[model samples]
Structures are given as C-alpha cells and as structure tokens.
Target: MSEQTPALSLPLIQPSQAQKHVTHNEALMRLDALVQAVVLTRDSTSPPADPVAGECHIVPSAAVGTWSGQDHALAYFDGTAWQFLTARPGWRVYVLSDLQTVIWDGTAWAGEATSLQNLSGVGIGTNSDSTNRLAVAAEASLLSHAGAGHQLKINKSVATDTASLLFQTGWSGRAEMGTAGDDAFAIKVSADGAVWNTALSFDPASGFASGEAVQSGPADVTPGRLMRTDYGYGPGNVLGVVSENAGIPTGAVIERGSTANGDYIRFADGTQMCQFNATLAYISAGLCSAAWSYPMIFASGSMPNVQGTLDSDSLALTAPSVTVAGVTGLTVSGLGSTNVTLNVNTLAGASFGSGESVDLRVLAIGRWF
Candidate 1:
C-alpha cells in the first residue's frame, strides 16, 4: 500500500492480502452512510449522544466534542463511530428538522427551491385565484431596509407612457392621478370610467398649475398671490381674488346698489351713468342743498352734467311775500365730479319767500374722465 493513499479511495489499497477485504468493507460502509443523505438536524453545535447507524448531520461552526474542528462538514455515523466529510459546493441534502432541502456553498448551507414548475394557485395568509394572482390578508405590511433608507418607486418606459394610480369603487374607475400619456402630472376624475374630466394639472416646464385653484398657507395667504373660487356666474365658473385682501382695483367696474333693478358702470377716470332721485326743501335764495357725491375721485376737478324735474309740496296759492304756484322749476349747479348742488327756483323767475318750499328730483349723467 502506498503511504500517500487515503483509506476511502476508489481503488482500495491493502497493507497485505489479509487486510484487503477489511479495507474494501470500510469503503463500502462509508458509501452506505453518505449516499442519498438526509440530515437529522442543521441548527445544533453539539453531536447527538445516541445517533442511529447511517444517520447524518451537518456540523455548525464553533462545534464542541467530536465535531469541534469539523465546521460546515457532514457527520456520518457508521454504527460504532463518527466520520466527518468536508461538504463540496452544490451538494444537497434534505433537512429533517426544517422539512426543507438545503445546499452547501463553499462556506455554508443555504435554502434550495424544492419545486420548479408553475402552479395553478398560491396564497399567503389568504386564498387566491386566477383573477387575483397574489393576495395577502394582514393589518399591515412593511417593506423596510436592513441598514439604510427605503423607497417605493413606480416607473414608466418613456415620457408618453402612462403611469398612474387609478382609484376605483367596486372595481369601477372613479379617479386617477399621475403622468398619464405624457410627462405632465394630471389628476382626472370620471363619473363613469368612459368619460373623464381633468380636475388638476401641473406643467413641468412652467411650474404653473391649471384646471383648478391653488392655495398656499393655512389661512392668511401671502400677498401678490391669487386664489380662485367658483363665482357661480353660470358659464364663467371661476373667479380670482387677491390672496391677502379684497380691495377692488382702480378700473372700470359694473356694480349694483341696494336696489337690484339696475346696474351702474363707473370708469377709472370718474365717468358714470346712473338713475338717481332725491327730494330737496328749497326756499328761494336759500343755501344750496347737498344731495350726493361720486363714488370715485376724479383725476381732474371736473363737474358732472345734471338734468331733473321739480315738484311743489305746499298747496297755498300765495304766501307773505311770494305767490305759491302749481309747479316749481328745479335746477342743479356747482356740479362737481365729487359733489352736486341742488336748487329750486320759482317759475315766475323770482326768489321765493323763506317760508315756502319745493321738491326736487333728478337723473344725472356725465363723465369724470
């Protein structure tokens, strides 16, 4: 026998003719212990005290007793003693403790797939079928990192590709939001899935929002920004207001007063046309009566044109110094864009006595521009 030959080599060696059978029998016993191997346990570091013959186990690191230096090796018992074999990479064995198969890499054992074909159905914590391929029944599930931050990302192949989250009611689409058929982000809703309406959109290049109102801050928005609301004007459904205040700008405006019969339009230059009426107590030669003032200030000190009617209030035919008449003539003067002066004069072209009075009514129309 060659001194360099192992006792378990394929070609058996014997020291002499008498020991040849003994060597062959030993090799046969080693084979019988290892072929079609199934490990009894894979987690323990200590050897079993009463292992059955032909039983095998995987040795763990830092092992004690007879397995002390045989880390990651297979321990096979041949009825009387233990035998250790260094496992090669890719060797597989069924683990009785775990009811699974494990494969040996160069350094350790790892799980191996037991089946390779497709199956009709599979479930995790719940039942699944053809329509819903995967299902999980749990309060919550977490996808987290072992050492660093984690992120969940959805991607599309191109700019025009649709990547969106569709919200549904009973599997009927109700809303969707994302980059739909383009790079711009959009939020769309549908009464029925077939007819969709865009509720909001954002332009990537302009950084502007459209199709809806955009607001900043909780209550007091920043100055110079605009917030929108539905004005309920029937066709023009939206209107904008200054974010911080509601002062009207200096420009043309169509406005209404307490009476809803008509509207008045005023221009920035102080031009106006309005239906106005008033009654004035006039004693001829009395101090001019003040009636109304313009709503806006004029750029220049210009008076508005005036026209109106006059009516008599007293029925007396004559007073101490002046004769009372059936009707009195009314006129307006000192007409400023800021204020108008009303006066009543007798039809006989004379100033009336101090005790007499008349009523004045008018329609004023002019421009401050």
Candidate 2:
C-alpha cells in the first residue's frame, strides 16, 4: 500500500543484474593475471605451495594439485587458485633452466636450433647427399694457424704407410708424392692404380735427389744421382762422375783433377787420344857390320815419320872395301808407316864384321783415331 517501509528498499534490485557485474569483474581479473604473462618455473609437476598473485608457470606432465590433468599448459595463479591454458603449436617459451628458446611443435617442445644424433649428409651453401657427405661452397677455404713455429704435418701409421696428395684425372689417380715404402719423399705416377713407377726420390739424410729415367723395360731404366756443390770440393763447385756397371773408366767424357797433370779425356772404350811426355825405345842386334836392317815394332795402327838418334858401344874399323873413312856411322833407313830400319856403314863406303848392337831413341807422335 504505497507505504514507505524504510528509507531505502533492499528487494528492489534484480538478482541477474548483480550476478552480471560479478561475472564481468571475474573475467577482468583473469585477464589481468594472464595478459602478457611471464612463466616462473617449468621444472615442477605440482603447483607451488605459496604462489604470488598474478604469477604463471608452464605445467609439466602429470601435473599435481590444482594443475592436475593440465599437462603442457600455461598455469596462472589467481591469488587463491590456479588456472590453466592449453598450449598450441608454434608457441614459443624461454626455458630458464636450459637458458634456451624453445617452441612447441604440435605435441612437444623443441629447441630453436636443431639437434641431430647422426647425419648422413651435410652441406653449407650447397646440397649434399650420401656419396658426397660433407660439402662446402665458397670463394676460398683455409686451414692454418695452430701456433707460431708449428708445422702442418700429414701423418701416417708407419714408415711404409702412404701419406700423400694425389692428383686425379676424372677421379683416377695420375700422380702422387709422399713416403711410399720409407721415410724418403718420392713422386710416383701411374697409368692405372694397379702399377706405379717412381719418378723422383729425395733422401732426407744426405739431402740428395735421384731421378729415374722414363723407360719401357727394366734394362732401359737408368737411375740418376745428384751431387751437391760441397760434395767433392768446397762450395761453388759441382761435380758428377758417371761410371759403367763394372766401375771401369768407360764412357767418361770429361775427367778433372785438382792438378793439371791429372786432367785428361778418353774414349768410351778407355782409349787415350792425346797425352804428354810419351816415350818409345828399341834395341837391335844381328845387323850387318856395314849393312842396314829394319828392327822397330810400332804399337799403333800407323806410324808418322819422326827424327831419332842412335848409338853403339863398339869400335869402328876400316876394311879393304872402304873408300874414304876408317870409322863407321849409323843412319836411319827404310822409313815406313809401321817400321824403321837402321844402317851401320861408313860415311864414305866402309865394310866391317857382323854381330853389332845399336840403341835407338825415337820421338813418336800419333793418335788412335
């Protein structure tokens, strides 16, 4: 009856109107806790006992407490209770424990940088496959600088082990250089991989190099040697001495000695051509006392005419057949290409007995051409 019960009315407000404000305020409070949220922990499966207001965490698997059944979700503590939001694919989170950035890949979280257990092929700036496992494409590549005074060494297991760089033609080895059967450095070549021939070798101990002549058969192979400047004499001089298999003086084109007396040249067959101070002697007997006889034997092919002198220790005697002299003299007669004859007669026609001896000295000049 229109009567004023009290100064204000309590039942005048509708219940739905009051509930509407409460629901809107609750939604606003949840937004305040979740908008731009930063998670605090991802390691624990259960909610913290005393979580601060508006704090958030990533719910682990089989979560406990208010976070139960909300695995891999974002949990937000709204002062008294925890609220969870399901994680979606491509959601990124920073892992405080690992100090890495991770992203959700539909079902699980994976690091931004990929990690692989093993890989068959890897390529940088190129596509690589099984046959060429590791490939790189760049302008230049360098491998250097271990330390100062350090050497880059290619090592092998033993002396006979091969450690070398091979040059190839269409993926076939053509040449290689390194230690093949010993520590000595050698360069070898191959028409095919089955057979190889050493072209050059270097000795580490003597600092010498040897080269092999390229040939078809074993008999045609001629091994070469190198001599240093300080080998036979002092510095600034080099010498090479080649000898036959039997160590004879054959095939010597040039030979030199420290003194002038020792320098000479010879034919390949060890025949001397020109030499200084050569001597030849002859002794003859059974010469007619006043006649001539040829008695000299030459050791060369041909003999050149030469001036000589002769002497005898016998006394001269005159005969009835003598015309002008009481003494006899010896003269060279019958000179030819191979022999020489001597005459023991008086200057003016004299005769004497037989059985006389003569000594001759001749200066022979010739060649073995």
Question: lDDT tens digits, residues 200-268, model 1?
Answer: 888989866765334442342545434533211222322222111133232223332323222234543
lDDT of each: 0.63, 0.53
Looking at candidate 2, the ten consecutive residues that score lowest on lDDT are 273-282
| 193-311 per-residue lDDT for model 2 (tens digits) | 66877877889798666656333332332345333222222323222232334433322333323222112233323233222221111222223322211122223456544444433
Model 1 misplacement above 4 A: 1-11, 19-22, 32-37, 45-53, 60-73, 79-81, 86-94, 99-139, 143-151, 167-174, 189-197, 207-344, 347-349, 352-369
Worst 10-residue lDDT window, candidate 1: 237-246
TM-score of 1: 0.49
Against the true structure, what is each candidate's TM-score? 0.49, 0.37
